[model samples]
Target chain A: MRPLDTAYMWDLVPVIASYVPLTLFMAIVAMAAALTLGSALAIVRVLRVPVLDRIVAVFISFFRGTPLLVQLFLFYFGLPQVVPAMTGIDGVTAAIIGLTLHFSAYMAESIRGAILGVDRSQWEAAQSIGMTQGQLLRRIILPQAARTAAPTLMNYFIDMIKSTSLAFTLGVTEMMGAAQKEAAGSFLYLEAFLVVALFYWVIVETLSVGQRRLESSLGKAVAR
Target chain B: MSCQIEITGLVKRFGDNTVLNGIDLCLEPGERVAIIGPSGTGKSTILRCLNWLDKPDQGTIRMGDVTVDAARATKAQILALRRRTGFVFQNYALFANKTARGNITEGLTTVRGWSAEKAQAKADDILTQIGLADRGDSFPAAMSGGQQQRVGIGRAMALDADLMLFDEPTSALDPEWVGEVLDLIRRIADGRQTMLIVTHEMQFAREIADRVVFMEGGRIVEQGPPAQIFGNPQDDRTRAFLRRVG
Candidate 1:
């Protein structure tokens, strides 16, 4: 409020930057796990598998309806309280599980829409060629679905990276935690937080560039 | 196996609407049959039923060595029948993610168990046959409707299926482009490919079909040589249809 301390913010950059890898690790691992499960859930929903689809619907609804912070708390604190054995799960593991469940639920709907968005004709054509269901999905449907879903999926991933900030509350010393500690020690809250904010901006911008490149590459076949 | 298609009691229904009523037909190897009817009369349904795409409510379809019973066709039987048959869709349903060449190679490599190299060679040959040799790398989105349908034909041709089915392939194309696609189909028929085509193109049907079938109300009213059907029709419905369309 009085005066921005440029020097202090600049100095805090490296200290907070060291935790970027831990932040990225949480997001990357969670995203990978979520993408796989989310895609499977989408496929199940598309195929309308009896019983399993209804169960997956309930699972998706619960995860998607709840906040990520609340889910993390439920997994890390509530679960352990209810089941003493769940106490074995450390903070990092709890955070990853929470992220995976929450985002996978959201990503499931987007991916389902993308899969459905693929032209119906593609399915008939693939079937006419006598391709097994697996071959049709792997060779034809998913490839086209990936192109339609990539942009949305990448958005979810970027949101996920930012969401990793909440991991600090789970007692993991990720980027946000590093900044909180730095601010608490030096009483330079503004400088510490601003530096971490810039780190996130840079990371997200780099990813935005990556998303564009990926979209174009996937678009080669349809590109005029 | 040579494509000897024997369809008996083929019936298909959509809820209360029966699309293909009990129909019996037979095709010896390399026979070219064209089905003509109004849009809702299920001319295309017969082709779809043969490949089990529409799943007949009742009937038995025997294509080459594989036979599929509509009431209880297993996954294996359906796939077996489909493998021996090729289908071209009205919408030119080319795989958008694949190039012209890739679309042709897809079934060859995956369904036929051909090596990638072999599939690529086959695809290239088909591309040339379809007169789009230079456009093999082009995607469906960029191609004209004629070119896309030609690629669709090439995709089916590369499979080297015992029987080929075309469902109003030119119905979705611009009038100008229809000729080129019909031309490609004619050339493929020249190779002695057993074909069953459902079409609105009366003249094309007349020119290409060894047997011409007229359908009404989900049933084949009459079928005969192209000369008899066109020059001297048999049934009242067939005569009315030819008059209305011609």
Candidate 2:
């Protein structure tokens, strides 16, 4: 009502843009690490390897059931007390670790479902054709599973980007953290929060568009 | 090229019921054998057992020089035997995510260690032979049921095995489409690639089989040349099955 206050909003743009790379860095690293870890866990679970499956199941369930913020807090605040080596790890590393552990659990479930969705006859056919267990997975099973799980994995990446905002609580001065600092200094909470929200919206929309393209191309191989 | 298969004392049980009590079959080189029987007579189970997809509780399968003990063979020897005996499932079972080309080339390139270019060339040749050459780039779902089934045949051909096994290859196709698939299979048999087929298409088996075997309750009740097995049955079960399936 007081003339829109366009000047303050325009001035905060560059300051927020400076933190863009940090936010992206966290998201990309977390996504890569999560995919690798999650795929391994998914393979272990799907094979139903004896005692190890139960351990991985418990680990995935625990990470998936809890809030990402609580995970970040635990890694950043609580972990250092329990493990001494974690004391020297900075806030950024802590944030990455927290994001990876949180998203990997969700991705594991997606991967497991995709692997199982491939028809049972495929496995029998592969075995009948003399494929070793490793060969069956590498040549036949994983490629098909990857196609089915791509859309779900992309969804996790989008969530991971949004979840990076929680890193501010861990003392990492990412985009949201930078905004919070500026807001406190200038007493402009509404303006700073609005600008940060716009940045997140832009990133999420861009990712969704890219994800659609990937799904379409992969869908060609899968047919239906 | 030596093509001989000897299955002895084959026994398979699922829980309390025995699907295959004891099966012993012997075939000469380049034998085109057709196994005909009614449903639940374990015709399909014989093909599955021959490939070791379902292991027999006791017995030995000797294809060429390799011997597979259904009850006691190690995993490595079992795989070796399977590699030489190609199988085509009734459902086709083409890898859904792979193109017809990819489906044909996987075994050639992966297990046999052929280069990708060579594998692609082989796939192209086989697709042409199977009459699905134009559908190579297409996915399984994009093609009709007949085309997909043809690709299934190409998949087995690419393996270059001494013996091929078909378990009701045309049973899943629509009535009109069944002929196209059967025609392709008949052509393959004409080439004398050595095949064991389990089929409900009585006319097809009559035309292509060198030896016809009528199985009932996991045992071969009657077997001879098509003329004797199809025209004259020595067992009542075979006679009744022919009346019903006819």
Candidate 3:
């Protein structure tokens, strides 16, 4: 009912800022984990490895088809209920697992496309030089695929950073969670939410700059 | 070790469309054979089949001490056969992500177990030999098509394979640049390293090939010394193909 409190909004900035590291930490770790696991899934799908290919296809379809919020709840709430040993899993851990699984499904497809985008002649050329399949993959295929997939992967990381807000529902006091708690005590929900949005905006803007720099450098490497 | 190549009944099919049908070929060590054929007559397929890049539906291929039965070759046998030969593709097929030197040295260090220093030394020599010594650090995307194909040939040469297979080496080059690539290939031919080249350049083939094999409809319709195939011409198909291309 009262006019929006400018002073209270200013005070919420540092409180939310204090939790930025935790948000970043969750996103960074999740991004790294997702990259490794996603690349493996991409390779499996590309190679169409026997039973594992079907299993990975199903896994990707489920994670991609479902909502991340639901998946987070399944990891944080449902898993512990079904599996007693998982009771000890904390909100942060659950969030990381959720982000890794959900984003990896999407990332796997991007990486798979990148791998396929590499010319078929590259494989033949590598083989003609006596390279083993492993050598061809590690030295030739993955490097090119990584370059092709970098910008998209960076976009996914930014998305994952923002998605870290959902971790608050599981009781982890990250940036959004901190803001929500700040608003609950002060009854200044708009101010708290505005500050949180600003923080995400700055972080994403900074990353977009980095993404452009990376793409330009890669472009230069290939430029005539 | 001798690097003779003997292929018998090499048949390749893509579902109902057969690309290579019951081909037989023989090459004594150091022979330079140019395979000239119409598009889709399977000249490229023959080169690919030799390396098991395209698995022949039915065939037996022997290179040096390695023999591969296309239908049932073991993984080790296929690898062994591939190791004995190098292939230069039509489109230059240089690794886009690597510099010219990296493309040359990758197989040496990774597959042949050469130390980094040794591989670099060998690569440097190959770069110079291919007339791209200054472009060793340049990526394929940064080079002209001719330069990229030179790097492709350099990458193959760095492997020290006894046999080389070229599938239209200069076909993808610009008209002006094609001469430089063909010149480099001619130099390699003079070295007598044993080669099977599938090419469209009649003049280059006449200059470099000891033997010329004319293929049509997935079969070697005629083959003999370059003088006979180019000048005399035994089969009507060979005469017609040469007439069309020349």
Judged by DockQ cut-offs, the docking class of candidate 1 is medium
TM-score of the second chain in candidate 3: 0.97
Q: How displaced is residue A135 in candidate 2, in Å?
A: 3.4
Better of 1 and 3 by TM-score: 1
Q: What is the lDDT of residue A62 in candidate 2?
A: 98
lDDT of 3 by residue, B69-168 (tens): 8878998898888888888999988887789999899888888899999999999999999999999998888889999999989988887787899999
> If you superpose only chain B onto the true chain B, what TM-score does each candidate give?
0.97, 0.97, 0.97
RMSD vs true structure, all candidates: 1.9, 2.2, 1.9
Mark the regions of model 3 whose C-alpha exceeds 4 Å error after superposition.
B1-3
lDDT for each candidate structure: 0.90, 0.89, 0.91
lDDT of 1 by residue, A29-90 (tens): 99999999999999999999999999999999999888899999999989998898897998
Candidate 1 error regions (>4 Å) = A216-221, B1-3
Candidate with best TM-score: 1
Can you give the DockQ of every candidate in the order shown? 0.74, 0.64, 0.68
Candidate 1, residue B188: how far the Cα is off, in Å: 2.3
